[model samples]
Target: MAILTRAGRIELANAIKQKSIYLAWGQGAIEWDTQLPSEPSSSTELTSILGYRKATRVLYCDADEQGEIQVPNGRYKIVAGPTPHLYCQFNYDFNDGLSKSIRELGLMVGTKPKASTPSGQLYFQPEDIEQKGTLLLLEHRPAIYRDQGVRESFEFVISF
Candidate 1:
């Protein structure tokens, strides 16, 4: 069997750093008023999306002997190591997703349309853009009830 070399893995990780990535949140189905939503074993996309936001930070990081990712510089940069560990950070302002219950999160890859200029067509809320991308990563957890004055921040490490 042919095994992929460490250099080959670093190449793949470097390639991923060039893509446009976004973080999306959704309100998945609930069994009842008392039951928390459960993550489906497999899903092509989020069941019900609240909104999508461009990643605040993306980096190629290294992992320790025990597979724990080392701390990366805060700036957006790529530093490929022996292992392919992609770190991603997403931040949502308090005004975003207000009064909604978020039960699922996904990492997506897609293009930014020509019409999507920051000044002309911003994507700060759910209605700003349609779910038009490949879902790369998915996570389901207990519902988080959003409030008007609370901001949401998430950090994820994707090992390729």
Candidate 2:
């Protein structure tokens, strides 16, 4: 699959909203739920895109909890605030071997999802950290990468 361009993202988001589809994440018996308006994501997508497995689950937190809970293929809505954006946090528990593989692959740690606006320009903020129960409004689009890349991309509009 080809990388998603700016215009592609907007077209995808519009399609997702019209369909009100559910995005799936993860593979091999592991998958997470997805929020509408944002792209459909899964652990499998992250594993392939980032080129690593062993990511146990993604965590969502807020002012209430620091490390709250673990969600398998979890999905949540985006809530708009002072800064409007969508966000999700994933927690990885890599085994010894997998950790080494990641480093070898030059996969950077703490790399968040690449996002863009309707115009297709990348947009994000430093404070857009993933928190539990933080609503992430998303715009869903077609998957860009092949293999796991087939997964749809969602642009975060706001966080609750």
CA lDDT of each candidate?
A: 0.71, 0.26
- Tell me how candidate 2 scores on lDDT: 0.26
lDDT (10s digit) by residue, model 1, range 1-160: 9998777876776777678788888887774236755555577788888888788888766544444433332322345543466888888878777888888898887735344546533234555554457788888777889998788988877766
Write candidate 2's Cα lDDT for 1-160 as tens digits: 8886645654543433333111222221112223223344321222222222212222222222232322233334433322221233322322212212121111112334223323321222222312111112222232222332133222122122
Best model per TM-score: 1
What lDDT score goes with residue 71 in model 2? 28
Model 2 / residue 141 / CA error / Å: 27
TM-score of each: 0.76, 0.19
